[model samples]
Target chain A: MDFSGLINDFGPLTVSGLAQGAIIALFALGYTLVYGVLRLINFAHSEVFLMGTYACLFVWGLFGLDQNSAAPSVGLMLLYLVIGLVGAIIASGATALAVELVAYRPLRRRNAPPLAFLITAIGASLFISELTGVLTHRNQKGVPPVIQAKPLFTIGDTTVTNLQLLIIVLALVMMFLLDRFINGSRLGRGIRAVAQNPDSAALMGVNKSRVIGLVFLLGGLMAGVAAVMYNLKIGVTRYDAGFLLGIDAFAAAVLGGIGNLRGALLGGLLLGVLQAYAAGLFGSQWLHAASFVLLVVILLFRPTGLLGESLGRARA
Target chain B: MSVSEKATFRSSGGVRGWFGRQPVWVRGVVVAVALVLAFLLPYAGDIPLLGPQIVTEGIDWPSALFNMSYYVLLALGLNVVVGYAGLLDLGYVGFFAVGAYGTALLTSPDSVLYADTGWKWLMAVPVALALTMVAGLILGWPTLRLRGDYLAIVTLGFAEIIRIFATSTTTLRGDRGFASIPHPPGEWGGKPIFGVTDAVPYFWLGLVVIILVILGVRNLDRSRVGRSWLAIREDEEAAEIMGVRTIKYKLWAFAIGAFIGGLGGVLFAGEQGFINSQTFVLQFSILVLAGVVMGGSGNMAGAILGGALISYIPDRLRGISLGDTDLYEYRFALFGAVIIIIMVLRPQGLIPSRRRAMELKDREKEVAPQ
Candidate 1:
């Protein structure tokens, strides 16, 4: 509809898309890791990310920082960042564990049908979000501008912001580290074994319960990091933010190959860029619609996703 | 019979056993009495303890009952897809929206296509249902081949897409939706029977529609299609191997479910005489789902009870205060906790279908350590 607008904004759109995709990629890893092992959608995982967002804000609040505060010195900013990250990681990890213990574990113990698990997941998700909604009075909390978005570089009328660079770099570093852990570590091997065949993994003394807990913790930790980066980029967090973003993250996971780690990264970036391009072509309101359309198209053609589900498969 | 089975049979011999042993005529009489009582519910405020306790204090009793009627309609429809067919459709609201929008497009003066003169609400009903059924089929055709979770997400996406379109499109009228939509038509003694202000007629109309739906759904449940749905739900691969047409039955479930959901929407549009994108939210679908799963997924009675309760509870909470705040604010949060507890304690739901209950018990046996 607006080819010229799209062409003119292509560079800027791609840069922003990559940054947004980086955050989505991290958020998606939580979904991918859990699905690999449990084959459950973990509908409450969004709430886990939401808890981290609030926790980081709470930490920053302790330093008397608000959205309007002047940027702190680099040394103090680094300390605050470290503290906020730790707070967010712990909060998210704890929430993930709590969700599993409360909503999922009892059902698993009962050998409840798969539908029951989904219902409970939804229940847990609603409970956490609604509680947060009540606590926050359903207000959108502004993130303290801990990392201001100064233009770091310019190319073809597209100025890449420092915030964007940080988000992309941090996301890649996290993904690389996660990939290594899954591919190289002893605990990661346990996860892969369980994912491939739960019964066999149990027989081989993989400690299925511990492995599942570890997976949730790792996913929650990644979501926490993503939450921080999202704060930096988006500058605001709301109770309902997770619901929409969760869909995007989940879409990315499925598009890239749900259980596949690297696929989430690819899927996230692709989806982000596509959404950006769609917004340019059709106006911003159509961005989400475009993503959903893209998701449906991909699922119809390649149900297994672009990379195909390979989390359970042995590392080559 | 096995020892545990004998014990269960002995335990079930109280109220249910008494009911089971009743003559067919006697059972029919009891059901007839229950139906009469349900119809008389709008007048419940005249009764002693039951009246004040059940009727919502915030809104008028008839209006609350009308809301309950539509909610029940949605639950019944969703139960067909989720409870009977075992299809997790997280976007059931999409069908409901389609039906409402269809009615609006045909009948509302505000509609771009129908600005000259709008059709009657009665005339729009069938068109709306047909549109919804078609929407259901369109969504089901491509996504039904995928696994259960995949179907769930796709359906969710479908609803979101509908909401977006409703919000963004000029034709649909977006947030400034179609207004002055005609109400359902009927007149008595120089006055419109289905006029604004009084909601009792709407409640009665909803009740009539619900009864018709229940009768139809019950008959379907006893037919080959219903049996096929059961077979598909219990084990799709096994059912396919046994010569059941899985895809056809699933599509039937989706379309029928859509039809029922659409009916609710038509009635909703007729009652409010307004249409908007805000009316159909993802949470609306989820609430109906919770109703189905919480009440008893595979049981019609359970779906009805769950649906009614989901509608009734928030309305009941509307006037109640907790400290400085209204209890209605915390209703969803409390409902979420309730869902978790119910699933944990009774995953089969409160009024689970007998066959489904038996199947679950058998599964529990199989899962128990050797």
Candidate 2:
């Protein structure tokens, strides 16, 4: 209904969109990895991310950074950031592993139906999110002013902030390493083999269960990074924050082709830009709706995703 | 929920063995007794011995009945999709919302449609059902092509989209909510069909509607359509190869499910006499799904009981004190635990269908060495 906003604020919108996209792209990797190997949705993956968010915040709190505290010096900030990342990655990866062990492994061993896994996953998710809600008292916890937004430079009339550049650069670097790990490593090959054909992979001596665990671990690690980036960008976190973003990341995963890693990256960026444009066109309240609509459209047009190649599958 | 003796062939020494060996009439008596207890339950909460444990004393019996019946209806509706058809519909509440909004728009005085062209609550039910069925078709058209988790996410998105539209739109009035919705008007003898605090009539109304739906669904389940759904659920590709119209049956399942879900929504709107976007949360859908799965996914009886228990548990916990806080506050946490534990212990559910139960336990039929 409104084209003027998009026209007038195109540059700023693009910058913010790309920055947000980086976080989403990073998060979407988990869904893609898990889906590629297990063919299960891991509905509690949001809790994995949730644990990371709170873990980082708890670490920052231990460092005595409250909302009232001023931003730290560059050296001190980098130290806190590294500490938070470590806290986040550990918490998130552990939660993911626990979910796999407690919720998924038993069902997998029993050869339970897909719906059983979905239902159990939902239960575990509810349990974790509700536990967090009760602990947090359902309040929005503001992150300390860790990475203040300062314009680093202008690119083609777009004011690019240092924070945005940091997010984008960090996301890209992590993704590159992940891509290499998943593609070039032995563990990654095991994951790919299992994804392509689980029975055959097992026949070839690949450890199916181990590979599955590794997939969850990698996904969790990416989600942990995404959580920190999200905190830096949004400046707020809540018990249900992971859920809201998880939906977006899931949409991105689907948009990119669920099992394809690169597609996830592409999907995340596309979704972020689309949402920014949508916010410009409509009010921000409809942002989620816009992403969902885009997802539906993409799904309708290309059900397998933009790049339909799964990790080890022969592309059709 | 108890295992009957004859039904416990795997364990022939315990209480089940004796119960199973009893004559046919013995089982009939058990059913008869259960029926009697169920019929008497709404009144039994006032009894001295059973009052407090059975229910919180002085609580509204009819309201409790209404709540249970409503959830049962939702669970039954969801069962058609998730249990019978095996579709993971995470956004089933979207259909409920559609039904409610359709009813509200047509019947509520706050609606523009009501102001321009008013319709009574009774007249809105059919319209609501049709609208909800159409909504289901629209969602399923693209999504039914995808299987399992993909379908789950799309349906979820559909619900969120519906909510966002409701939230952002000026016509729906968002949080202000549509209120003063007219209830179904009529009288029995000289008495009104509906009255404040008299939830019995509404409960009875819901019961009647549920029975009709159950009857209809049972017939469908026995018919070719039901067979098609079963085939689809077991294996979609295999079913398709067997000449079953997979997409057609899936769409049919979706529409029928939506119709039933819509009926629940209509009843809710009529009973509540008001509706806002708040009532259509995704958790409500999950709760109903849990009920269906908890009771026994494919079994109609299990679905009904499971649905009733889901609502009944929370209401029963109300007014009961635990330390300083109310026990009801922990209802969801308990519910989550129950789901995980139940799924792990009894994946086939409380009143599992013999076929499904056998299939789940089929793991023991390992191949001998060739």
Highest TM-score among the candidates is held by which one? Answer: 1
Against the true structure, what is each candidate's TM-score? 0.96, 0.93
lDDT of 1: 0.90
What DockQ class does candidate 2 belong to? medium
Compared with the real two-chain complex, what DockQ does model 2 have? Answer: 0.52
lDDT of 2 by residue, B195-307 (tens): 77688788878887887898899999989999888899899999999999999999999999999989998999999988888888778887788788878888898999899
Question: Residue A30: error of model 2 in Å?
Answer: 1.8
Candidate 1: tens digits of C-alpha lDDT, residues B1-370: 3456545644675566677667799899998998899889889999987778878888899999999999999999999999999999999999999999999999998887685648999999998899999999999899877777767778989999999999999899899998999999999999999989999999999999999999999999889999899999988999999999999999999999999999999999999999899999898898889889888888998999989988987788887897899888887888888889988998888788767788888888866341
Off by over 4 Å in 2: A314-316, B1-37, B56-61, B363-370
**Which window of ten consecutive residues has the lowest lDDT sum in model 2 chain A?**
A307-316
CAPRI quality of model 1: medium
**Each prediction's RMSD to truth:** 2.6, 3.7
Pairs clashing in candidate 1? none
